[model samples]
Target: MNARGYFWRTVQQQEVDYIEDADGIIKGYEIKWNPKLKLKAPKSFKEAYNTDVALINKDNFREFL
Candidate 1:
């Protein structure tokens, strides 16, 4: 299925690097260069949209690609 989506950036400067509409389900992702950093999805994005959020860092990026 072809998915349509975009990055969610807010006035407060919080951002989700990518948001994808996979069929009817939503998915959110945050990319961080630091593999040790533990990051969560922006609060506004999570509260506004129902999605599975994940942090993609140097260590586990291969899975996404």
Candidate 2:
């Protein structure tokens, strides 16, 4: 299946850096420069979608790939 990428942000400023839509399945991503920084999917976004958001950093970015 083909995938399309998009960026999402709400008027209130909640955001997900990247979103991948593969057919009807959705995936969310947030890129971080520092591995130690705590990153998580926004609460509003998680409440709306059943998908998990990945926090990508140098140490473990390849694992997601």
Candidate 3:
């Protein structure tokens, strides 16, 4: 688990449910309880750091775990 902050005078924050550094690559993930809700990684985080993002929910959480 990791929390990141973005600052440009005023500060903004984003939390990733899980993160891993594999071989030199950074991956980001978000977990949601609702499978029906379509979600994506935060735009600020994505734009700042180009990396893989994933959504874990009831329907597909098993595949991730």
Ranking by TM-score: 2, 1, 3
Ranking by lDDT: 2, 1, 3
| Tens digits of lDDT, candidate 3, 7-50 | 22115555666666665567677879898877766676666658
Could you tell which candidate, 2 or 3, scores higher by lDDT? 2
Q: Give candidate 2 regions above 4 Å deviation.
A: none
For candidate 2, lDDT tens digit of each residue in 9-56?
999888999999999898999999799988877988777878789899
Scored by lDDT, the top model is 2
- List clash counts for every candidate, in order: 0, 0, 0
Worst 10 residues of 3 by lDDT: 1-10
Clashing pairs in 1: none
By TM-score, who's the top model here? Answer: 2
**TM-score of candidate 3 on Cα atoms, chains taken together:** 0.66
Candidate 1 vs candidate 2, TM-score winner: 2
- What tens digits encode model 1's per-residue C-alpha lDDT throughout 1-65? 98987888899888899888888788898889898887877877888885558999888899988
For each candidate, give its TM-score against the true structure.
Answer: 0.83, 0.87, 0.66
Give per-residue lDDT, candidate 3, residue 44: 67
